[model samples]
Every structure is written in structure tokens, then in C-alpha cells.
Target: MKSIVPCLWFSDDNCEAAVNYYVSIFPNSSIESMSYYPDEALDEHFIGKTNKVITAEFILNGQRLMALDGGPVFRFHEAVSFTIECEDQAEIDYYWEKLSHVPAAEQCGWVKDQFGLSWQIVPYNMGSLIQSDAQIQAMMAMKKIIITELENA
Candidate 1:
């Protein structure tokens, strides 16, 4: 087993869809394996997961992650997120287009994906770009980060 892997919990029982969607969006990504729940659930709590995906292991942009159909006991929130260091506006835009799903959750450089996972799509050196208060204010006003605007500010 990998020393450490971020496991994603999907209370919706759509682990397969979430894994496939993420792999499709990210480059250098692939589904390593997917284990299905037994037809006859081993426990009463697993009844909802019967015939569904018990877990899926995958690699997204060289990062190993596991996703599971862990019924509605928990959910994804904004406290934890993945950060994508983009080299340019195009890279940021590409990831934004593919990952931003929840419109209301957008702020600064944070975006929520279809699976409710949060992601920070930003330039490689955002600190150097948004050094001034003006630039910080400019970034705060927008959802998808505009590198040019931040630099100009």
C-alpha cells in the first residue's frame, strides 16, 4: 500500500463516475483499480452500497487517490482542497473549465468540482503577482483567477 493516499468519500454511491470523471479531466491520469461491493451486503450499513463500487484507486497527475461509495454519513467541504500550480493563464483556464462545477462555491482561486471536492487553480507564483493590496482586492472580486488582471493590478 502507498504510504499515504487521499481517500475521497462519495456518499452518493457514485464512486465510479467520480473516478472516471477526474481521470478524464486530468492529464497523466488513469484508474488503477475498482472494487465492487458484494451482491449480498456483509453488513446492514452496506446495503445501500450493494452492487456499487466499494472503492476505486486511481492516479491523477501523478497523485494517488482513492474514492469510495461510502454512504451519506459524511461529505466534502471547503476546509481541505487540492492546489494546482498553473504555469500560465491557459493552464489555469483549462483546469477551471474542467473542474469548476459548483457556481456558488467559487471565490478567489477556489473552485468546487462535480464531486464537491475543492481545488485551488492558481499561477505558479501567486505571491509575487499579487503583492500589492490592489492586486489582492482584484483577486478577491473574481472567481476564476485572471493572471493578467492580477499582474496588471
Candidate 2:
């Protein structure tokens, strides 16, 4: 088990499905374990949802993460986001294709997945590339970043 892991909140009781979806997208990923609500633990509010997933532990590209079916009390927003460093444009495109769902959320390589989780798909050397003033301007105008454009800038 990881010392620390990010837990995603799913209000729709789809934690297991969401974890499986993420595992499918990234390499070196798998479900470590899953825990469901027990029948005896089900209260009146959760009478028919006894077997629903309460928590699921999974790994994505070596990063340990957890998903929780915490009910409809909370949701995900842009305040927190996961960043993926891509080695090339292909890598960027691959992640962007899989994770991006909201068209309007695509800004400067940041995208929101179907589950409303925000992610930033950036080149591995993004920090060094952004050192140049021109590159910064080039990046500002793009949704999904193009490594070649940043390099040329």
C-alpha cells in the first residue's frame, strides 16, 4: 500500500466503474483492491445499495489512487487537478483523447475528464520550454499543447 494516495469523490455510486475506466487508460495500472458496502451496514438511505462500491484502490501509471462512492453531498472541481507529463505530442494526444470530455475546459493543456476530474497534460520538459517568453505566449493560445510549436517559439 502507498503511504499516501489521492482519493477521488464519486457521487453517482460509480467508483468501481470509474477506477476501471482509469486503469484502462493508463499503462502499468491495476485495481489493488475494492471494498463494497455490506448488507448489514446498509441503512434506510442505502437499503437497496448494499453491494455498491464504497471504496476502490487502484494505480494509474504507477500513481496510487482511491475512489470513493461518497454519495451526492460533494463533487469534483477545478480547484484540484492531476498533471501528466508527456514525452511527446503523441503522448499528449493520447491522454487528451482519453481524458478530455468538456470542450470548454480545454485550456493550455488542462482538460476535464468524463468524471469531471481535471488533468493537465504537459510535455516532460514543459518547465524548461516555458522559460522562453515566446514559448509562454505560444502555450497561452493553445488548448492541447504542441511540443514542436513551443520548441520553435
- The 0-to-1 C-alpha lDDT of every candidate, in the order given, reads 0.91, 0.91
lDDT of 1 at 91: 97
TM-score of 2: 0.93
Tell how far residue 139 is off in model 2, in angstroms: 0.6
- Candidate 1 overall Cα lDDT vs. reference? 0.91
Estimate, for each residue in 38-131, the C-alpha lDDT of model 2 and write its tens digit. Answer: 7845467776568789999898999988899999899899999999999899999999999999999999999999888899999998999888
Report the alpha-carbon TM-score of model 1 versus the true structure: 0.92
Per-residue lDDT over 1-153 for candidate 1, one digit per residue giving the tens place of the 0 to 100 score? 648999999988788998999999888999999999976656776565667888999999999999988888999999999999999999999999999999999999999998888999999999998899999999999999999999899
TM-score of each: 0.92, 0.93
lDDT of 2 at 146: 94
Candidate with top TM-score is 2
Candidate 1's clash total is 0
